[model samples]
Target: MTNLIRKLWVPVMTLMAITGMGQMPIFKRYYVADIPGLAWLGEPFTVHWVHYAGAAVLMFMVAVITIRWFADREPLTTSGTLRITLLALLICTGYIRVVKNLPDIHFSPTFTMLIDWTHLLFAMLLGVAALWSARTGRRSYTKQTESLRRI
Candidate 1:
């Protein structure tokens, strides 16, 4: 389980964010439209499947990491902690938006827009952070390999 998580976390998060980001433009366009510009995407359940499914897996992974992090008794690294925090926040905002901004849900225009933009902003930041984290991990991996070769 630990090994699987270590290998798959970044890829999973990256893929989820990509799909979520891809869905955003359509979401925004049709969020308040009369004819519903994004009907081509799919029915509600189909469109939401990507978001909800990714979120479920992500939450499960986060729970696993949180348990392991506490169990290991290791010092928390700042970057790792920050990344986790951001990911959690992103998931939370995404959930709230899902509940609040649906076509059937009638929220104030300002409030709906706020949730939409908030979700987008968090998603963007999380994406950038994930990319940076992956790059940093690869650099360390390369450095270790080079040192091992020298040895």
Candidate 2:
């Protein structure tokens, strides 16, 4: 469990922020719409925000733990780069599995679709970051290894 968290977790707080914000209205106005479940559940938008907030908080905690403690070293170094890439991919997967799948669990069409797109955008950014970080780390490692061999 510790290894899994350390090796394969990067939580995106933006998702949490989006969901939490979406759900806030649900607590107050309840649903103005006639969707049967929406009213009973107290505004799906609110529910979305609440869900997002919870996810955000959980992700934030995990991220801090992984970065501060589990990571073992800074990502700018070669050994740490692999760990960072894995963490980023895991986060991307979570966005697909968690927020993107919320529509199936709830009845908010707009909320569901909107979140999916946002998650996709985040995934793209993560992909780029992972690639760049990994390449830089590899180059640095190669240079160090070559210098040591020459010495």
Backbone N/Cα/C clashes per model:
0, 7
Tell me how candidate 1 scores on lDDT. Answer: 0.67
Those runs of model 2 whose alpha carbons end farther than 4 Å from true positions after fitting are 1-104, 138-151
lDDT tens digits by residue: candidate 2, 56-95: 6557656676665434443255544554565566566557
lDDT at residue 139 of model 1 (Cα atoms):
19
Whole-model Cα lDDT per candidate? 0.67, 0.52
Candidate 1: residue 87 lDDT (0-100)? 73
Q: Tell how far residue 142 is off in model 1, in angstroms.
A: 20
lDDT by residue (21-129, candidate 1, tens digit) is: 5565554465532345645343444555766777788788879877876675555456666666777788787888778857787878898788788878887786787
Worst 10 residues of 1 by lDDT: 138-147
Top lDDT hit: 1
